[model samples]
Target: MISAQLPILQVLLPLLAAPLCAILRGRALPHALSVGTVLLSLLVTVGLLIRVESTGTISYAIGGWPPPIGIEYRVDQLSVIVLLIIQGVAAAVLVGGGASIVREIEATRAPLFYALFLLNLTGLTGMVLTGDLFNLFVFLEISSLSTYVLVALGTDRRALLAAYQYLVIGTVGATFYVIGVGLLYMMTGTLNMADLADRVAGVEESTTIRTAFAFMIIGIGVKLGMMPVHFWLPNAYARAPSVVSAFLAATSTKVAVYIMLRVVFEIFGVPMFLATHLSEIIIGLGILAMVVASVTAIFQDDVKRLLAYSSLAQIGYILFAFGLATEPGVTASVLHLFNHGLMKGALFLALAAVALRAGRTRRTDLDGLGQAMPLTMLGFTLAGLSLIGVPGTVGFISKWYLLEAAFDRDGFIIAAIILGSSLLAILYVWPLVERAYFRKRDPALPPVEEAPLPMLIGIWLLVGANLLFGVWPDLATGLAERSALLLLGGAR
Candidate 1:
């Protein structure tokens, strides 16, 4: 018999350990405990994924009550994929953070920093695992509040401003989400996602339900860093501590995309909404985001900001897949969600290492860096290759699927737009690669070694993962099929 307790244990192990890390009150103790807890959580997430894939959707009701009346934690292919992303990436970030965090944070406050990181991980894991919409909001806020504090811990005073800016915007997003939930509750009288899906389909004509959908989409779009609403990401990423940047890049916005997927495919049901041109609207905005953000990235001198813009453009591709509203498209979207997380996380962490060695992340700072820190720059190049959808990289797998999806629907214009966006990616990434390797600089400075071992190893693992998945695309593609089938209410 499959045990429902495992899901709760998966989330609670790290969550309950968070307070102990704070209470232990020392750098060594807390870091060790935090890493242990995250490792344990990762194991649990893997076990849960295996269980779900072998069996089917697993639902664990709180207090043994049924859903829609009592709270529930549901694990399906979609939830399992998200949980794996959160825990697996969190483990990697924590491993990498060991040295980077020590370098960046004050020794006295290291314990608190780790404690907050665990809290943020707990919140994100919870968000992915929960079946209730209201509970999703609770976890969303938990992650958001902790993230604000984490971003503010950067050495730059501008980090404080970035944190505050994110706070204002995050609060607004959360408030809109809450209002949307309230509207859904008023009409359907339930918040469980499965039950809500059934009810929402019946009431598609209800203005309140439609308004709820609109509110929730807009709220999540803001959080997901959708175009015209992504002002908070670049500064927040640029100013945050390196460890924070790595962690946020790996996990935060990915969770936001998860919430959007939940809202769109699970709750709204694509068939009901596709006729309304919701998919077309999402694709238009996505194309705009892809083109505009890539161009913006090309102009950025700050490496972090350049990457932040690149991240926005990457999100545009994922959004474009969603807009296609086909099984292949949705599958591509889900696959990219995982692929981009690994790619960007590796890229940003490499930047953190560059910052550590050179003390700056500007394009000029990276000049002649490929020779000074060959390993670090190699990692950066691999990640950049992934971003541009080079064959044998995870990025290529997603784009390939996206192209196939576009062609499936005779969407030549959309296919062209996708390819054009990739060309833009090359424009932004190539300059840095050029500056690092091909460009000449003064020959007098002492050659720097590669990033510290933990950072180097952690980044390489992700790069390796990117390539492994790229060369063998079935790992994510197969899971994406399961996720798509689940989201489409077993239509496959």
Candidate 2:
């Protein structure tokens, strides 16, 4: 018998292990459990993905009850793709972060770090796997609450303030999401996402449903770090411990974007809204994010904040593709989702290594780093180049597809915006490369050594993956295309 328990075990292993991490109280023990739990989850994710692909969609009726009556855990194409990215990237980050985390966070707090990290993992996995909307919100809260605590764990005093600010903003976002879910429940009398999709289709013109949709978008927008709603992100990324920044950058916002896609394309009945102006709203916001955030990123002095702003801009590209609401557009968005996770994860780990070796990450502080820590900075440069959409890198593939989609819609102006933003990315990234390589060495600072073996191995894993995906875009794009169709209410 196929274990109906696998899905629950997938989540519970990490969820239940979190407290044990704290109890084991041994520094090495927690790290071992964290890595082991994530690896096991990755295996589970792979099994689920293959099972869904081969057997068609599988919905495990929680407690053996049917949907709209009992909770269901549905493994669909879209969810499977997200599940793979979350668990896969998580496993990679934990491998890369072993040494970096120990250096950056206090040893006494190591167990707590692993505990919170596991809780966050549980929340993200739960958010993706559940078929119920209210359950999504509950998982969202679990992720956000754990994230706020993780951010606070930084050694920097400012980490506390950053976490507090994120707490206020994140709380407000979660409250809005709950209100939206409440409204959705009021409209359909059912909280199951699939059931709600069926019901919302019949009431396509209802004002209540539309309002609920709007609230949910705004709520998820904050979490996704969508523009104007994204004020909390830069500081949180900049001030949090390096490992936290890397993990959150790789998975958190990407999962939030998955929620938005599910709501817009799956739950909302895509055919009903395809003719509406909602795409224009998304396009407008995305354009604003691309132009404004990229411009802002170009001017940051701190490397971490610069990457944070760049992340906001990258998200704009993903959303822009989604806003186009075409197969090509959605496919590009999904491809970029995976690509950006790799790029940002590698970049942040490199940054952690720099901060560990040099005691700072200010752009000026990075002067002559190429000479001192050639391998580390080379990894950073490669990831940065990918971010610039250089050929033979994952970033280039995403930009090529996004621009292609824009052209398909005869959106020359938007195409120009996309290209213009790529140039802005160049402006931000090139300066760091120049400073690291061309500028003279600072005499007061000693020669930098390579990042520890664990850090190098971790960073290389992501770097190699980034290049492999770039060369063979078909791997991700094919999966994304299939997932995109499933998201569009099973549209063929």
Candidate 3:
């Protein structure tokens, strides 16, 4: 019975566990429940991916009602790939976060934290799986609301401020998305994405449809932490708990990028998006974000904040790929989306270990950390190499494809921008390497030890995956190629 309902079960398992977590009192139970629930969801996701790969897309109608009216849960190669990333990251973070959560959150609030984490996971999974735009908005809010609370649960007082700022910014983005949806519904009289795609083609020349496109793009851009509107991200990631930072850094913006890809190439179609000169605008912004954000990361004193900026820069790379509006371009974007998730998840989890030992992640705090926490710092270095696009790292595979895409279009300048921005990554990452290895420890400080075994397990899992995928990228590239073809094929 559950096998027949895998699409809904994948999301429902986490959603159901969230409230149970809230009602439960014991910290251990809630943590265990949360981890168990996500692991279950991950198993379901794997099943779904296998099923989809063998049988093609899966569509489940809520309440036995058909689509174009009732809500639909859809699973395709594109969404299943994202589902794996979201669930994989969430499960790993929860498993590794036990020790850190004990130190970082109050005992009484711990269950609620786990509850919120599961809820956030539910929302993200729903957003990717849902086939209806209005349902997508509903899930988006579920995830956003949960994210706000999770951010506010941080030990730092500044967390409250960061959550409030994100609430304001995120609400505006959501509102913009809904308004766009309303316009599309107004024009097509349908909320189903597949139906809308069919209906949208007829109205492509309509000013209303064009306006809707603009609203949706900007809304997703805000969520994607695109340049200029990305102010909320650094503080949110910097001040949130380490687990929250790792999860959001890896999953949230990447989901937004997925929505953007769906809307632009799947719904709006590449020709329509390019017709408005939006592609050119996006390409320019992508370059600006890559250079500007990477340069800013170089100057940040806080290690998390630096990575936060680095995330923004990575988003720029994905955006640049999308702006190319070609099949290989989309393939590069999708590949980077997965690769960046692996790289950033490993980096942040490693930093979480450092925070567990040092109690903070400022640059000065990490000084001479190499000797004190050699394993943790080594994991950080391995992931950092990926961030710098070193060969035999996942980051290199993505950037190489990106460079090829740029060169294919006779965009030598774009290729140079990609190379130059990577150099900026070195500028920011080198300081950490130097501080951790080259600098001497402040003898006045107490001795620090390596991260707990569970934490080390989580960090190394991601780092190992990065290296493994870097050397053998066929799996990621194959899925990405399929996704790009599906999007460009207009199969929704």
Q: Which candidate leads the pack in TM-score?
A: 3
Residue 414, model 1, lDDT: 84
- Per-residue lDDT tens digits of candidate 1, residues 231-306? 9999999899987887787788888988998888888888756866878889888888889999999999899989
lDDT of each: 0.87, 0.87, 0.92
Model 3 agreement with the true structure over 1-492: per-residue lDDT tens digits: 777799989889999999999999978999989989988899999999889889988989988999988999888888987887898888888888899999899999999999899999999999999999999999999999999999999889999999999999999999999999999989999999888889888889999999999999999889999997999999999999998999999999999999999988878898897899999999889999999999999999989999999999999999999999888899999999999999999999999998999888989888999998998899899899999999999999999999988988999989999999999999999889899999887899787898999898888888998999999998789888999999987643
**Between candidates 1 and 3, which one is better according to lDDT?**
3
Best by lDDT: 3
Which stretches of candidate 3 lie above 4 Å from their native place?
none
| Reference-based lDDT, residue 479, model 3 | 88
Question: Could you estimate the TM-score for every candidate?
Answer: 0.97, 0.97, 0.99
What ranges in model 1 sit over 4 Å off? 1-3, 440-447
TM-score, candidate number 1: 0.97
Error of 1 at 314 (Å): 0.5
Candidate 1 Cα deviation (angstroms), residue 414: 1.5
RMSD of 2: 1.6
The sequence of per-residue lDDT tens digits that candidate 2 reaches over residues 1-492 is 645566777778899989999888757999998898999888888888778778877888888898889998888777777787788778878887888788877888899889999999999999988989888888999999999999998778998999999999888988888888888888789998888887877776878888888888888999999998899999999999898898899899999999898888888866644666778888888999999999999999989999999999999999999998888899888888888999999898889888888888899988888988899899999999999999999999989989988998999999999999999999999999999999876888776777888888888888888898999877688778888778763722
